[model samples]
Target: MPPIRYRVQANGPLRGTAVIQGAKNAALPMIGAALLASSGQTVLRNVPTITDVANAVELARAVGAHVEHHPADRLLIIDASTVTSPLLPGDLTRRFRGSVLFLSSLLYRCGEVIYEGAGGCNLGTRGLDWHYRGLVRLGARIEEKAGTIHITLGATAAADLYLDTPSHTGTENLMIAAATTPGRTVIENAALEPEVVDVARFLTAMGAHIDGAGTGRITVEGVDQLHATDYTVMPDRIDAGVLCMAAGITGGTVQLVGGDVLDAFGVARHKLEQMGVTLRPEGAVTTASRLGDLHPINIITDTHPGFATDLQPPLMALATQASGTSYIRERIHDARYALASELTKLGASIVIEGERATVIGATELRGDTVTAHDLRTGVSLILAGLVAHGETVIENGRMIERGHADLVARLRALGAHISREELPDTTRP
Candidate 1:
C-alpha cells in the first residue's frame, strides 16, 4: 500500500459547517467486543475511514469475523458469528495499540489469549503493566516474554479492580474482560471519558449489567452471552472541537451540528466560554470566533472534563495566533508536544518544558515544510498551514487519517488551500 501524504495549502479564514463522525476513541473498543458476542452479526454505523478503524477491521478478520467496510456509506458490518478461536494474528496486532483490547474480550470467550505487544503513539512508555495487574486481580494468569503477552483465565470471578491510575484503555480492557465472568466486577478510579460511557451503553444494550458509567466507580455484573444489536455511536467530540477552534482561529463563522456539547466537551466548552467563545445549548448549532482584538486565554490539558490532550495540539496552533501567552500542560500524554518543532518551522514561538508548553501568540505565520509525528499533530500542522501567509506542504499525512476522515475535503470546503499529494516515486531505487 502507498503511504498517503497531504500537501495542505494555506487558505483561511476557514469557514464551513461540519458534522462530526462517530467517536473513533469510543468505536474501537465496541468493535472489539463484537468479537466475543454470541454468534451473530453486529452493524456499526457512522464508522470513520481512519487508520484506527482499519486496524480494528483487521483485528476483526484476524479473530475470524467476516468484516466488510462500505466507506462511501460509512457503515462497517462485522460478522463474528462464526468465530472459532481467540488467537489474534501477531503481525496485525503489532501495527496498532488498540489490539490490546482483544486481551479482555478474548479472555471472556476463550479463557486464554496470546498476543503481541500493543503499539501506537510513541509519546512515552505505554506500559500494559496496569492492564496486566487488573487482569491478574480478576483471576487471569499472565506470562510474558519477548514482547508477547500470554494469558490464561483461572477461576473467573468479579473482583475490585482499582486502576493504579484510571488509564483509559486499561479500564476499558478490564471492563470487557469482566463483563462475562459470571460475577460482579467493581472498577474504581476508572476513566470516565465519554468514550467509556459509549462502550458501557453498548455493552448494556447487549445484556451486560453495567452501572455508573462515566463515573469514577463502575460496576459490571457478568453475563453468559451478549446479544447482537445495531448501534449508532456518539459524535466525535474531538473533531467538533477542532473544527470549532479552526473557525475561531481563522475568524470565520461555522455552525457545527450533530454533536452534544455537554456530553463530550463540557469542560472544554466551559473553558472556551471563559475565553469568550460562545457555544449554544444542546440541539443548537455552535460557532467560534475571536473575542474582540485580544486573544481569549490560556489552557491546560487533563483527563476527561478537562481540556482534552487530543485537542491541545490544535489549540496550540490557535493559541499561536492569540494575543497573549497561552500555557498548555498535557497531563495525559507528555510527548504530545512533538509538534513544537514543526510549529517552529512555521515561525511560531512555542517553548516546551518537559510535559508543559507555552505558546507566545503570533499575528502571522509563514508556511514551511513540516512532519506530522502523530494523528493530532498532523491536523495541527494543517490548521497552522491554513492560517499562514503562503503555501504549506505537510508531509507524512498518514498520521492525520489515523483518526479524522475526509480531513482534506472538509478543509477544502472550508476554503483551505489543501490537497492530497503523491510521492515522487512509487518504487525505491
Candidate 2:
C-alpha cells in the first residue's frame, strides 16, 4: 500500500476523553528487558497497539521468545524462557530504532549479541557513543566491526557506570544490563525521563533493586536472577500532552483519561498553565480546558523535571494559536523542526533558525496538505488540523501510527472530525 494519510476536517472544539496509551518509549525497552528473565512469563499490561510495539513483538519472536500480543485487551505476554537466539533480526532491527535496546538484554541472557543494522526516525545524529561507552564501563566488551555491533558480556557485573548525557535508552540499557549481575551498579547522570523511571519500576517489580529513578543518579543492585513479572506500562505522557495541547489550541475541553494525574507531565502542565490554559489534575485523570486566550510562553527542552523534547512538536503547534510570539529552543535534536515548514503551509508564522524557532501566534491557521516526517510531527500536524479553518490532509501518516493507536478514532470520539484514508500505492509494479 502507499503511505497512509489522515484527512482531518475541523470547525470547532473537541470534546470527550482521550484514553492514554502505554508509553511507546518505555514499552520497547521493557519488551527487551523481558528477555533478561530466564524463566516464567512476563505479562505487560496496557500495552499500546502500535507498529513499534508490534515490531518489538516480532523482534522478541525472532529471538526465540514466545510473545502473545492481545491488542483487544491491551496486554503483551512474553515468554523468554525458551529464548535461543543471540542475533537480532537485521531486517526488523533495522526498521525500528528501539531495537538497539535489546543489546543489553541479549548480553545478560546469552553473553553475546551481534546486531548489524539499526534504524529509526531521522532525528539527525543521536550519538550512540554514550551507550557504547556506558555499556563498556559496565564491563561489556563492545566492538563495531563491519558495521555490526558485537557485544560480549563481561564475566563480572558492572560496578559503576556514568552516562555522559543521561540518555534515556542508555540509562535503561545499563539498568537492565546490571539487573542480573552480582554487584551494586551505580549510574550517574542517569536520564530522569518518566518512562525511564517507569522501566526502572518495572525492573524493580521483577525483583531488581533500583533507586533514585526520578533523579539524575540511579543505583541498581544486581541480583542472582530475574523472574517473570506482571506489570503495566505507564500511560504515555507525551500522548497525554498532545491531548492537552489539542484542547488548548482548539478551545476545547478534554479530560485525558488513565494518566497519573499529570504527574508524569508535570513540567508540561506548568508550561500550559503559563500559556493561560486551565489544567486540573485530580485523581487519575487530568482535565485540560481553555482559560480564555493563550499567551506566549518561552520554553527550552531539557532533561526531566524540565520540558520534554517529545512535547515540542505539538506544543509548537499550540504556540501558533497563542496571542504572541512563543519562542522554543530545542537542545535535544537538531532536525526536529522538519515540521516547521509544514506548519507554515497551514499559515503558521514560524521562523526557524537552527535550534531556535520563533512561533508567532494569534495567527489564524488555514488547513492545507502537509507531510509528517516522524511520529511526533505527525501527531503535531493532527493537532494543528483540529483548529484549522479548512480540511487538512496529513500524508506519511504511518509515522503517527508507529507510536499512537487509534488516534483518529479516539479524536473522532471526542467530536473532532477526522478520518484515516489509504493513499494509493504509486510505487507498486
lDDT of 2 at 298: 96
Q: lDDT (0-100) at residue 341 of candidate 2?
A: 93
Relative to the true structure, how large is the alpha-carbon lDDT of every model? 0.80, 0.88
What lDDT tens digits, residue by residue, belong to model 1 across residues 6-123? 7665665667777676788778888888777756778888888788889889887877778888888778777777666777777788767888877887777677888877767777
Compared with the true structure, what per-residue lDDT tens digits does model 2 show for residues 65-138?
99999998999999999888899968899778899899888888888898877787889988787777777777
Q: Candidate 2 — what's its lDDT?
A: 0.88
Residue 312, model 2: lDDT of 92
Clashing pairs in 2: none
Residue 355, model 1: Cα distance from true site in angstroms: 2.2
